[model samples]
Target: MEVKIMEGGPNDPACPLMVDSSQVTQISEGDERDVVQSLVEIIERIGSYGDYRRTQRKECFNLVRRMKLLAPLLEEVGEMERPLPEEAIACFCKLKKAFMSAKKLLRTCHDGSKIYLALESESVAGRFHSVNEKLNFALDDMPYELLGISDEVKEQVELMCLQLRRSKRRTDTQDIELAMDTMVVFSKKDDRNADSAILERLANKLELHTVPELRAESIVVRKLIKERSGQNSETTQQIIDLLNKFKKIAGIEENQGYGIDNVFLPKSLEKSPSLLIPNDFLCPITLEIMTDPVIIATGQTYERSSIQKWLESGHRTCPKTRLTLSHLSLAPNYALRNLISLWCEKYNVELPKKENTSLGSEGSSEHKEEISAVVRDLSSHLEAQRAAVIKIRLLSKENPDNRVLIAREGAIPHLIGLLSYPESKIQENAVTSLLNLSLDEGNKRLIAKAEAIPAIIEVLRRGSMEARENSAAALFSLSTVDENKVTIGSLNGIPPLVDLLREGTIRGKKDAATALFNLSLNQANKLRAVKTGAIPPLLQLLQDKNLGMVDEALSILSLLAMIPEGHGVIGQQSFIQTLVELIKEGTPKNKECAVALLLDLGLTNSFHILAALQFGVYEHLIELVQSGNNRAQRKASSLLQHMSKCEQVP
Candidate 1:
């Protein structure tokens, strides 16, 4: 239809101009002279029907009702004397009612559908469906004349018809998009007849005939709702009234323990979308997600790792309220450990421990039957020879290469799911599973696709020391992929890793060092770390009391210093001092790391070489070369030869 663009009145709320209905009906009936002109007017003024219907709901409904009531009255007057004016008014009223009602019903269905979802009860679901059926029936009653107004309107109508027909003719992907478009149309304001007809048609197409209320839109909603918090306002009230039933379900509640206050977000981490875990809810240890939810004897749940990490970090007061969390009466519920154990027992192909007896009670026939059933189930699915680890070990003795490092890919997703459980053991298992799975690129891609990176990164920040350690290893493997590197950078992995290195346990320190070592392999990542002021913490690692950790730290630093640009960023006072200290007091491994770092730095500039010579690096290296373990002696020889070459080149 030709839509006319008309100027809005000064008082109009920046809306499109609306066309008068009488002129349009007159043009539609039999007159072709003003049809194009009237169509242009309507098209020009076609303010989004969706927006107008939303703000003017009550006004629109009242207008439509008056027009419907006046239709017969005007027609009767037209039969009497001088009825042209009355006839015009009657036609105008009928046309207004048709278009206005269509828009109003569309809005009602959209909002009502959202409420129906929160109801969730079967009886209430039936009631909502009944209302839906009525709406659909009403839509079907709309006059086909409205759609046939002009060729332009005809085009839109025909398109809708073709889509509806195509959807029925085949099981193609286009049907999904068409279904989605139908939802959008239903969301708009439409007259009762149009609204009900679309609903009925969509219901049939979607096999929603039983209860048409659950249109395609509701299906999408149900998929998004992971868990039911049970407490919903609108639909819950409607359903309770209909079914006369009351029930309680978990909803958003304050997370006790860590003192961080809540904030709002588009989606929630919890099942209830309303709950907001504060942005600043840093775990005290790794300063990330609370690895375990701790329930004290007093019946309260707090983030376990967060509270512990805070205490270990020497934060006497809570970050939120500044209350002394350490003194708060509390104990670890071992929630994580228990959950992890259960999952491992059920799904783990490789049992961490051996069972000494039958899985069930002895002697009773029932017990024997159950045990036999369990064994049979295991044998049918899992390889019988490998179902039991003891059996696998016997086979491995004869065939060495047959042993596999991982049990299954689901192991990671399963472990990752455990992170949602309120247990540390589950989190630990998840971290271990991720670490073990990272042994291959295929597994890494799968984990990445599952959106495990962000969750794993979050866990590392909030998980237990062991969790944090394992997470670092997993992230290190993930960083090898370019996409994961960007993900790691986005989640602010540098500061957390630096914090872990500075304050973590021996294992945490080692993992953090290794993670950073892997991270340094990427120039962009190394630059990001350097830019984030991580050089000091990383440099401090060169002097780690643990030889293995020192070696790993020095190795990453050596790699970073190898590039001319990398040397400019990493070759600073902090790095030089740490290297000098390692040269003076480090073990053989530490010495090798320091030497590797120096060579990379000197390759860019002789400045690091001259500094090393001044710091007695040459003497330590010569002594090691002259006498020591073969590995240490070889490293010492390697360092001296490089230094001698540097001198000769100058």
Candidate 2:
């Protein structure tokens, strides 16, 4: 069948007959044909719906070319032979006539009287232009009203306009799918504005669902919400409803992961007035909403009522893990600490600074004023600072500045009270305070006078890293005076400190090493550490991946290994074996430390001699002897000489 462009009326012998069955199937079959027809019609209209209101002549030539391109495909779909080359000229001529006729009719704005003329005419392109111009003009304002028309009439007219514009744009299948999806999602929203203009414009280029239909869906959901929203238990029911809707959606992933708010609300509400709970309870640090608010040590749900109990214990949550904080998990800046700081500031409080000490010369006048100003402020806020100080006393470790303060004349008794607080930060802080106070001769005598050593040592045995480190530092400080050294050694601090050497964190390990180092300065503490299995861990730590830790451990081990018992410990265990391996395999600095330690340990045992010889520790020592680092050469030579002497010692 030949494709025909409608002219004026049914009188034209060239009047085209659309394959009625094909057109009907394309319209209602709701398959790919519907998609194709809908798309083709939209494109044709956008292409041919020329602007007629312009006084200047605008080109509708592109629209003609577009219609000509789609005419062949429409013909092919009707199972007609492809239009002959001659049919193109006839189609163009007929289209031009119809559009011109439509343009003339639109001039009257006669209530779509022009549309009826355009549809009825077979030979007049004037009718086509009239309908196109009016739609383009009307759609330029309100589009939604046009979309709300009856589907039957809309689909038929839309198919004709779209077929003409289809050739204007070569839209891809993906573009069509995206356009469909965008229409589906956006058209469902409540839009009450001049949507007619948009819908009319879209009718020219898109298949947006009617705005009225969208509003109807919203009305349905709103009715449902009205019927259900009055119940007191509605929020929980709403969650269930939302989840059910989610589950009903086809192809939703089965494992969507847990919902944070849904799981936590019941227990959280049971424990506290729900009003006190923020609608969104999120951790400030993590920024995600909180779940499973566990209480540490107290075994209670963390809620408004339990928050005070946690604060009293000087603990806060793990910033990363979102777990209930204990001494083991507390962050550096506990929320309570900030709370206390805010409390101090609110009441006009100031924190104390360390004692004003000049580095070299006597105080300048400017420095003196600064110091005096600080002291005055500290005095004014002393109560608040003391409160903060009291809180710090509860920790198992003392921050360095706090340690310095406790060494002053009056910080001990207040620190002692926190040992019973059960919070490790408090206990640690108490230990730190004791450490500081022990450093001063007067305070040391006072601590001994108060018999604080036993209590301090008890914490050393069971306290957190902060507590142990501070206690160790304190024990070191106390032993600076002879009586205190004997006092500390007698309290069984060596075994615990060494135990910490094996199990402590890097900082804890460092503290343990330093503590042993301090104790080694006193001969009894040196023997005690060597007797308490400190050598192997210290030796192991000397090979630590952390260079600074390695240096500190080696220095401590080097100091302790000078003692006879220390020498025996190093030789008897694989301490010497590990060191010999380190010397053979380690960097020059490590080799130097290992060899120096071996020399100090005297290389007496058969295991020490055999391992050192088997591992070629002597060869590395010789290489070190040739190096320019005088320290390495000296230590290496000393090690070789010691190995020579070990042969005679046994």
Candidate 3:
């Protein structure tokens, strides 16, 4: 069972190292500070993994010590008031990737199978060495002088680097001995020839003495094999086979042992280990695996792009918690991200690349020039104008910078003119281009201020379905500004939007509903919408579950109920009956909306209250008051109080 101890060189955790210079992509300087801070936070969490991986304690200690030295420097740079020099930022970006790799390795040590890990000690040690070398590589190239760091801290960093350079060439001898013992125990041809004493010692060390522990570690090993993306099938199968041998040695029967510890750290991690897709891995909105999960203030994680879109659409509450977020800031969830990355690796799932959402930040000089040329073509002949607008549409949707460049290139007025073109293609591309451009927050006011609202409204009234959809979307995005809401309402925008909401395709209807919702926020526009036959279709949408818009319809009706005319229109017996039914049979949000609408209706119309009372609405109201959410309970109580005030009539 004797084996020679290996020296640390290429696989040495103590070797001085440098990351490949080419892997250092230029990160946006504006984001580098936050990224550094995030790295610091993740490293802090990684420090806690020392409690596990007793076999790899030496490697874990080395990793934690190096990170402890790196954290202060990271925080110092993150807190610098002056802009970080481009060289330092580049170095930090490279370090960001390296630090994330270190984190993944550390997480594996904590979550992976102890027996499999013990058998693969050299590989695990090599991984630790790799991360350390990357760290050394990053720090060695870092420009400490240009970083504006204090001399005392600079010397400490220099010492840390020197420590890595002088690291004694040695591997954990205990891990080496354990691996030899395991191999000798398993390599024997006969049970009598194998060393049971050595096997017993290995099992205790691997924490496989109990049936449940052996079974759990086996599950962990299988999970590791599945998640170890890009590994050859032969290698994965070998690891799985080794795991089964250990389980057989431990005398545990399949399906008889207790599985993953029921005491999971978070509710998000409590899914059965056998499930291919963990429930928490999915974005609540998209219901797909999240590529870039972020934590909202409510401590709920969601796909970053999805939640950003939700915030942009003017929703201020957490999607799952339904509580108003204290602030709009989204913190990166490094723990969840590592967990998801592991899950994706196990399944060999290729996650989508992280998109650069901060457009115009990249070195997009070529895009700027090309977009300028394209914007000029908007004034060319019909064919050229159509071609130019198509290019502009793509450019505008691609980045915020393109939208800025397009506006500056004099494409806005040209696009506004094309919005009225008799040619449906040009009109569709033009309105759609404007719709794409309006995604930029600054462009919202620019688009509305350029006298484009009137033309956009006209397109909403008569263009093709796609054009009308985009027109409605543009109006909705633009109407975020208070002045644009008035401008749109004054230009008779509400009628066309209401028309689209009633008659358009699904996307068109969604766009129209959103625009009408935004426009209806204005007191004057609410009357405009209610008077233009918007009520009938909105009410009709209540019973149509397939539209998934009962809440939207109720929201609009609630706003209109503030006015006498809209309230009278919505006070019809059928709509009140529908709201009552929803109170008894809807989702939590549906019940809340239904209660609010009924409360709104009864504030001025005693007949509506009498109608609801006739339907036995009191029982539902009492139930909601006792068990519904805060909003629903308050609204329901108010409805009951209002109903109680109404006197008997002959």
Candidate 4:
């Protein structure tokens, strides 16, 4: 399409230089290794621009400097031991591709018609400006958390993107003036000889006044036309027309056989060296992101169907390397599957559906018989016991009614026994099964009555991460029954759970916090929790913004603060400062909790009230009294009244 011009300049149709879609870099989709290597190659290519006959050398060097800054981040990505999650690989690919296209544009500035370049100097700036915008887009697309990028490198890249965004409005007066003068020469079409001195100056400006220089210019413009093959025809034609004018002024002739016939074959750009699957998320066989990934004996992960198909086809080998397999069994790759799930959720891509296995009601007598098998085979083959408990876990997970049936069939006691198993997976499956069974109210009582609380707490202290996390969950579920809460606390469950809350995974911490929250609801267990030193972790969780535990921490602290031990530990000036911060910056619910906690503290100690005043809490209290929620308003007004009384007394 002929772009509309702004009525000046011979960069014919110097419209905002609308980027041609064809100019967008097309990165061939590759596997994890290829993705990392592509990033390295693109960075190298971008850095390879020499100082050879380059226009806008400063801008080109600036582009190189920006790309070099990203190399440290790429090196970190390359050194990562784990495969880059599919989404992170995609981000790297996008960043690499953007730099690749920018490299090509920079190459044009290095070797294309210098007189045409000097003429369209503003357009040259626009090209540099355009690539920076592309880079900004790629950087904005990546989720930094997916990659293991260091804070320093991430900050540098972020700052680079900020500069690129701000560079859009940058201009150069010299380029603009030179561009206008060159346009005037192109405008005087018939009066070609009328500006020999102008042509001499243009030739001098571009170092193109010599015959050999004229010959080289003709050859380059011709080569560019052949390379373009007429895509950027108007720009190439302007380059041609300008080159020919210079030739006429230099008493030289255009070389028709300027080696355009050889068709300088560019190297193949397919860049195919590895797996056809696009990324780590994809199954090597199916070439799609695996919803249910499984690892085979060869230690290769593939979608469930891919593994099934491979084994079904009588191929006893890993599809990726075609290597011989030691065994045909496939294990669930829970870790990669989880990563894929997070990637899908982040990108808002829906997972493909699997057949629904969740029955609406309890399984029949046959299923009950299977539950007996778990109890019957409790001390049998380890694998069989594991398989049985996993079956029980799956059944219990299907529905609440099924859990009642599974518990009645005497699987809970055996599952709890298996929690002490030596094999980690069996222990994980067993504890998880008990956790599932404990979801039913009756099963919660039975599981607690079976002396399972100590065993579950043992697993919480030393089981596999999944097992420990599930033990905490099981504790939380069982603690839901008011009677079981006392049983759990009496079994010495509160301390290990407090430890898990202090030093566990985010899920484990959440589960431990919830169990503690429920157990603390019982007055005696509140003292038990306090004695176990739950205050420090609770305070840590309150300060953590990413864990989403602020509300729960405040609630638990508010409850514990009602007692003397809680008040002693939680009523410190630092804790009070955190509450005041919450009142100023937290959500309305958070404000209400902070206000209530502060009011409780202030009613007992004048220091907390005065500290509130000293921390500049009066205006915040005034704002809360006006616009806060009803509970917040009431709490704030009461606190204000308390502060007023404190001021009068002191």
Candidate 5:
């Protein structure tokens, strides 16, 4: 069979190629000659320099490069002198589509500059790259027996595809080199003295150059000193003298200037005899180290007590930055507090503990009495109970210690009882208080043991949005305990959570997703969640632009995918493409979850392997295998291997 390129002007009626019904019908009638000739003509047209010169030069270059590689494989099929199989005919149709799309894109480019610009556009480049990959696969992935091609022709096509891949890799390498060259030029012009100084300090602190030699000498000196001490004091002194002489001879400095003396010595022993504190670690109002640091809306940290006093005095501006306070809420600076504590521990200094208002100075009895007073007020008439609930919520918000105190005062029972009240506001406040109190593990157990799950579930199902949000939050906190997971799941918790996920506001959706995430940790709950229609809402949540929500949604879906029935349901949705997108564009945690979900689906059903490939997951998984973290790499590798086995089975 042979094909000839059609010669015609750009304005000719049939200027561009077309794959019509008659051509397919001809191939189906066992007319191998017509099919092969048509394919050859298309290949010739793709490679002709005269035809390419009339279109965009750059687009034509790429299209020709791809078509040139594919031409030989198609020609090999033509040389087989047999009718095209159904699969081969399908492959040809895809090739024709690629050809037509590329031609149309090229024809739209008006001039040389437009051609260059269009080729440089990422979207255009990506589309062309995808087309090329598809063509490569169409030729390389066909089964030889189905195509009636001899082994020699199959080997030739495979080798040509392999060479094309190597060429593509070289192009990628060149691109990386260009990027690195640009970055190097910018880096050389940038100021980086501070970064260099920090690196130098880190090197000195680690003793990267001197520690090994010091360790070697210290071992010998310690042994000699120990052996001589038993003989006599004089001999021990002589041994120490010998060690000092050896140290001098070896040019070992007595102090390596680690600053340990300054760090370890008490303030009384220091030469300056004053305590030193980092400026960032002290509150501006008192000029004292912050014990309970909190950040205001202006992004300045202050000791909570000092800031409270300032706010109470009607100062509505930050002391350091002098910015107006937009809101009165203070978020705890936990990371800063941790750093301060670590600094104190390194220098053997005691950190002063900050006391909460709810705790007494003396002991547990005084604390118990204070908590009892609050709870008593909460159990009173409506106004007083509301005030007490607000007070307890505020106290619980201050610190975990207050929460422990409130829980010990039997506040869980009272809070749960308030959930059944007629007033929605009171129910919301009660649940909010419970949410805060449940942060303590002990309180979680106590709340669950007090049969608070039923009331929380009731609030979740029937209360206002705020109440439902808080109830879900409390359930999430409680479900952190393994036993409480079963308790919540058994009390018909899955359906309400799904409802919240489906119809709630953004915040409500996040809270519901979080609760479902925790509940899905239990295997029984995962199965129950599937039966309760959890996957559809979870899939909806997966599209959220919030990374946290997407992460939580993917996590719950991954767990649900472990169930066989759940796998079938998830696979039914057009979710594989979304999962693949996440793999390419999501955060590290999101990618990890996405990869796990895909791997689970692939393992559960062999048919899913083909779906994964159709969604272009292989490239992402291969990239993960090369560059992802340990767990992601492991799962991606396993999935790839599984897909490979599925392909080989037939």
Candidate 6:
């Protein structure tokens, strides 16, 4: 089957083909005839330049250059016509691959001087310019519409065009303008007037011949002022007003004398002492004047509502001091509350009514009896047990005292028993109740003593999504006890937890990672987790966008990287690269973890030391040494010293 390239029509037999017809037919099947025919025409057009390589080498070289540019566009066209015939797709792929191979082979066949000689002979440079113009005109006329293209493919093509435009050299001012025009066009096409407006402003600013850095800063400041002006915050509005007044008083023009460094400082801009509220009168949590003030054990006072909400959410530290509270107790700071009230009165501001600071602290004995009744009903009929579990869970969430009371009623054993029940709902509520109860330090021990680790592991393995998450949370709380960590690992709990890390919901993943993190603290448990194939999922969790999970995941990996087997598993180039990236771009804690992990890996092998250097870890370490916290700075300094010694050896 000979497929000849016809100049006019398929029946025009007088036309000459560039390659042997047999070669064209061998490249494609019958279904691809039309697409193959179109491609062959393009190839023939490109091959015509070969005839002139000897007498007109420059023209031929220019033709080849034009074909090089068109090759990407041709590939893109083929991509847009998907659901395309397999033969056509195959033909395109083969053509692209073969063309690149042939070009490479041709280049390798000649020395650089000989290639230059051929290109420069026969006035080729002048002739090539003519050929280039013709090729550009032909490309301009070529029809590559978006008619049959999918939206995704269209966007991809547009992105390709955008990248090509961006990669153009900007040494020429014309190129910069063209780039700006390209951005404006793209922004308009996306129906984003804000983006287009930004581009237009940049172009107009460029015309002023301002320094790029100054112009960029000016634009940023203007945008900030505009955004702040629109916000409803009083502080933001005040800042905007102050800026405007400063500009007016200093006779500063927005376009002319605007640089962040050149701003005039006025004495009046400093906050006056009269405007300051006494620090002790402000709640540390809300940073506002205290109303219904309550004092924690750390001696820091917070608004009652704020402090209660913090404690209810399971935080156990003073917001201001970060000292662990001796208990979740809040006593009314009557003196501070009265001072705030007097201050408000003197300032002619209306003081808000005091919040109800009590959370049933003095409930009647009847209420206590009711809670005890619910705890005892756990052994009754199934419906009664369900209601009782729900009531206990509610009570436990209300106050720390309630949690202690529920724990004293011997609910831990019943909750552990209900975890293995047939109904998923019962298991979920039971696990929820246990999670709440375990928050109490005393109950954590009792739950651990009851050997509830196995039941929680069961829920983690087979419960519903919510149930699994709660079970993982319960495990996390229980593992806070050193004994439970050992027990959970010994009960084959590591593998299921690792499985949850791999397949659980976002909340479940966080809980499982945290649980594994706690368990990994035990040396034996770290080995067990790694033996259960926890490293890969842990590494995968490091890639998560959730900062909490990433932090926990990194902490676990840091611990695992200590042992010989753990070091060997984590010292892979890919893992090292991920850590390097995190060090450069992740949150502060993540940066700390990454630096620590890299330090561990570097200790295991000189190869890791070299790998870290390749990944630009030295600069990050130097930065950390200068500015990071004590732990980060210490580890980074040690690693840097070690790396420096390695560098000195040669």
Q: Count the backbone clashes (under 3 Å) in each candidate.
A: 36, 58, 4, 0, 0, 1
TM-score of each: 0.35, 0.37, 0.46, 0.44, 0.47, 0.46
Q: Residues 327-389, candidate 4, lDDT per residue (tens digit)?
A: 777788998888867865665556666524343223344555666666677657876787787
Clashing pairs in 4: none
In model 4, the number of clashes is 0
Candidate 2 lDDT by residue in tens digits, 1-650: 33333444446655422223323233222232333343345445545545432111122343344334444443333332322222222332333444444434443222222211221222223334344543333222222232243445445445545644442222111222222212322322333111221222222222112222222222333333355555534443433333222222211112223332222223323333222323234322222223323334423233222233223322244322345644432123245445535643564444333222223222223433433333333224545444444443332132222233333324455455555556676676566656644533456677676777777777878887778766765665565457776777888878888887898876566556655665666777778777777777877776566635554566667667666676666665466667777776676656656776676555444456656676556776777788624445656665665667655332
In model 5, where do residues sit more than 4 Å from their true spots?
Answer: 1-369, 546-548, 648-650
For candidate 5, the per-residue lDDT at 296 reads 92
Q: Report the Cα RMSD per candidate.
A: 29.5, 33.2, 28.0, 30.4, 26.2, 28.4
Name the better of 3 and 4 by lDDT.
Answer: 3
Tens digit of lDDT per residue, candidate 1, span 1-650?
33222234324533122334444444333233232233333323332333321222333333233223323322333333421332333333333333333333434333433323222222322333222333233233334353223445434434533433442332111232222224323333322111222233233343333211222233333333323344444443343221111100001122333211121211123334343333333222222233344543335344564444333322344433334544544465575546534643454322223223232222233423433443343234323312332232232222111212222313344445555545666566556555555544456677788778877877787888877877876787676567877778777886678778878886676667656765665667777776665666666665556434555556666655655556887766556666767766777556655665665576567777777676657776677667544435544555565677775422
Candidate 5 lDDT by residue in tens digits, 1-650: 21112333334434223334444444544444455466567667545434332223454565566566556667777777556665566456555555655554554332222212221333444445555665565565466688766677677667756755654332211122122112222223232221121122222222212323323334444444454555655534433433332232222223223221232223323554355667677665544467789999999888887676556433466755567989878899999999988987776666556747332123445555767798998779989898888888877863545677788777889888999998999899899888888766568788888899999999999999989987887887777678989999999988999999999987778678767876887989989999999999888877867524776677678768878878989986389888888899888767877887787787778877787687788888889989886557666867877787886422
TM-score of 6: 0.46
When 3 and 5 are scored with TM-score, the better candidate is 5
The local distance difference test score of each candidate is 0.45, 0.46, 0.71, 0.68, 0.64, 0.60
- Give the per-residue lDDT digits (tens) of candidate 3, residues 65-172: 877887778878877888777667657655776777888888878878786577666567657766777778778778988988888788888877887765423312
Better of 1 and 3 by TM-score: 3
lDDT for 343 in candidate 2 is 46
Where's the lowest-lDDT run of ten residues in candidate 1?
243-252
Give the range of the ten consecutive residues with the poorest summed lDDT in model 6. Answer: 169-178
TM-score of 1: 0.35
Residue pair clashes in candidate 3: 18-137, 226-346, 227-345, 227-346
| Candidate 6 local Cα displacement, residue 552, angstroms | 2.0
